[model samples]
Target chain A: MNVAVIGLGLIGGSLLQALEAAGHAVTGYDADPATRELAEKDGRNVAGSVAEAAAGAEIVALAVPLPVLPGVIAELAGYDGLITDVTSVKGPVRALGIRRFVGGHPMAGKETSGYAAADPALFDGCAWVLCLEPGETDLDDWLTAAALFTALGARVVPATAAEHDRAVAEISHVPHLLAAALARRLVGNPLAAALGAGSFRDGTRVAGTRAELIAAMCGGNATATREVLTAVIDDLRQRLDELSAADPVEALIPALREAGDARRAWPPKPGAAAEEPAGAEELLALGRAGGWVTAVSESRVTVRTMRPESDRITP
Target chain B: MNVAVIGLGLIGGSLLQALEAAGHAVTGYDADPATRELAEKDGRNVAGSVAEAAAGAEIVALAVPLPVLPGVIAELAGYDGLITDVTSVKGPVRALGIRRFVGGHPMAGKETSGYAAADPALFDGCAWVLCLEPGETDLDDWLTAAALFTALGARVVPATAAEHDRAVAEISHVPHLLAAALARRLVGNPLAAALGAGSFRDGTRVAGTRAELIAAMCGGNATATREVLTAVIDDLRQRLDELSAADPVEALIPALREAGDARRAWPPKPGAAAEEPAGAEELLALGRAGGWVTAVSESRVTVRTMRPESDRITP
Candidate 1:
């Protein structure tokens, strides 16, 4: 397979190296001249521009940052080949309605940025989400993307753009805000800051991320992020009210126990493996059931589901 | 100095070992026979009861769980020697009005709790808070406790019980609740659970803590926790509303930047060292200013303050 990755940043550079190592002819490009020079110096197949990169490629991966995505998307107008992106947010990109486009976001990253920090094994054992919108996304292209990621040692998760956005808002975007909030509380109270230990450090770890990147990710998916943030706030506010009650320990024990049980049972254990020739809806169903695609063929998809006991949410 | 450490769980056992390593005559006791036998087998001076351990000791340290603390406090009804506690909450213990008592809480712990997991170096480089209520606490006892913890390689942070409770709520207790709330969000969403990565893992790290311990710690400091939690919720709510605006990225950039700045500046760098013969009021002021006691003598206390530029909160 011939692959073109635009924007030689951390994710893009990593994908290029990983795909090349997996026997794909990968052409890489970056708007920054120094980055392209670095990649060229490093002996990667560096393309001068997006057109030159995508000219002979079967799959074109847009690995640019969110702010740069629109211009890149516009530049690729009328190519008619399979396209995918590695942007964190999915809804806005999916709404672009590009022909044969499959939205992708690999759930992996590092504190460092740029092509200099790229590693071929960054995606190994990571969950790579591939958006499969009903009646919109091309199945063959989606399968090719899944196969490409699977060969690089990533488990492919199938979902619609809406599901991807909401899931990430719950797991990623909102968490960044929560971390920032926790970090902000330490500001005027130096005594509290001095007392911060493992819990405080871990809770606010992501708060160290660049502010602009967090704002763009959370703001790009504002509606979903807001909804999830509201739900979390509601849960916390209820706990606050309970703490204010006459018997806080007794009032909050049941809820805290439920949370603890759910947390302890998390990243649920994989159970039975089932495979069948599946369409878009079927693949989405498997994903919603806490399952991931172990392998994908032209006619069939194999998924492993979680154990029954661990699958259910604690009531 | 002679010291008695009661309750041989993780913190108690670790404190006992650390104190003994510092060359104190340390006698330990636990209500559980198995724990006492384990300590005795380990060549520790294990006593059958709290009374036996406290007998003829210059200082009695209660390292019991919060629930067990009241019982131990009751048992020490007539103890006239210097006393201190390692309970996370300090207000209730300070309110107990025990003579010659200094309330203490070490900002250090491990996930595993038992005598077997004890380490002599557990408190090294950790902040051990000692409560010094203005008129209620004895200055000599407070200084003695500070000297003892400082000798054990722990920084002594002098604060009033109210101040200590409020600070912990902001830094520790509330962060635990936030981690629990974040963990609870993944309860029913398998897709979200699969998407969990560094941010989710770090943000929810403390959710793995025992539910009962969390409930007691957060509940015991209910008033302070509630106040700090409400402030955090308010901050998050403002961000949610900002995300709903016409230009969310623009609306949220300023607040996010401030938070990022605070986080990055965190741990304000240590500046000049100051020494003075301080009383309870002066020591409390130094703690409030984020200065920690390095050494304590009968006449003077040596304290280090943070760099001026990093000490101010981002406006």
Candidate 2:
């Protein structure tokens, strides 16, 4: 199979490497001559122009930045092949009205960007969203893309473009905004920055992400993002109001408990570092309460009674 | 030196262990008998009552929750020794007018609490804030407390109680509120949880922290916390309003760039995982840009000209 990837940056460069490793002949092109040179230096075929890359290719993937995506898509309108994108947002792209277009978003990214930071293993065990319209794209075409994504160690989930946009707004886009907001709050406070520990660092880590990329993403899906943000702000306002109640501490109990439980139950990230052994049933159960493992160690064999639910605050 | 720790939970238990390891004879007391038993089981000296722990102890450290701190201070009024606390907030505590009192807060904690999670190395290389008033606590007493904190492998930062509270509001307390708010948004959304990646997980990790503990900390410092929250919400509201602007993406540039720059320069957490080797200066420099090491790899040394600022989005 021949695959042509346009815009040889992080996602494009990485897709070139991974697709080639998966036994596909991959070609790449970028508007920037330096980026094309970088791809050639990485031992991948580099096309002189977008038309050259799209010629005689079975699949063409658009991996460009969101701001320049429309121009790239317009250039690729003459290509007669399966088309997909790796953009974080999908609603506006779906309205682009390109033939054989199937929207995709690899739910994976690093804090860094460009071909230099590209890794073939970037998409390994990651969730990849596939936006499909039945009347526009046949099942065979969608299946082909899904199979290729799976070959690159991705778990493909099929959804409509609107569904994908809403989900990304709640999970990815708004989280970035929150991180950036928190970092903005810390701008002039050196003492706070010096005192920021694991929690603060973890909470604001995403704030270091690219500014334009975030702007393009949030701007492209303004309606969905705004809707989610409105709901989130309303929830937060309710929480803030409770802080001024007669029994503020008592009022906080339910909200805190619910949030804690929801956060605790959220599935752990795939390929996350395993802090404990994977085999849980065989290991001695020290104790459990309120869905939290009270105590379990590698060498300890004593199994104590479970603590009360009130005592187990977090998992 | 004789030290009394009047709480045996995570912070108190760890303080006792670290202090004992630093060659101080320590006595511990807890309001709950179970906590005192846990301390005794760990082979630490346990006192029968708060008065018993305070009797003849040269230093009394109150490590109880914020709500009960005043009562604990009142109980120790007759001890006539240097008094300190481990509460997250310090302004209200400083107003208690206790003689020879110096406020301290260690910038180190875990989501999971209790004596079981306590480790003697918990505070190693952590920022420990010490609050001292010129006329209230003599320099000699403050120096004594500072020396002990230094002995336990802490970088002691001396500040006024009000300064400490304001900083904590921005860095620690408000971050918790944001995390809780994000987690609350995720409560009913299963697809979002399944698709949530590193950013969402890290941003909301603190949402799983104990409820009562957060309530106590926030309620204890309501004035400072509310002040910081108001500013943060204002910043967020301004950003949100820009989503509807004529050129939304262009408008997002300033806020995003400011956040990215601030987050980039924020000091890495003390004792964080060493990403690169500690001795980077000795190694041949590949390149440097904007206070960041542009490129360094073990494979080969290839130096390239830095890209323009507009093109260099993510670091």
Put down candidate 1 lDDT per residue, A1-315, tens digits, no spaces: 999999889999999999999999999999999999999998899988888899889999999877788788777775668999998889888877778899998988887989999999999988888999888888878888888897898878899988999999988899999999999987778888788777888889889888888888899999899999999999999899889889898888877887788778776776655564557887897778767776776454543323234555566
The candidates' DockQ values read: 0.71, 0.26
Query: What is the lDDT of every predicted structure here?
Result: 0.85, 0.74
- TM match of model 2 to true structure: 0.77
C-alpha lDDT of residue A71 in model 2: 88
Model 2 chain B poorest 10 in a row by lDDT: B282-291
lDDT of 2 by residue, A103-170 (tens): 88988877688999889998887777777664665555665676688678776656667767887888
TM-score, each model? 0.90, 0.77
User: Considering every candidate listed, which one attains the maximal lDDT?
Assistant: 1
The true-structure Cα RMSD of candidate 2 reads 13.6
Candidate 1 is graded, for docking, as medium
Q: Could you tell me the interface RMSD of model 2?
A: 6.2
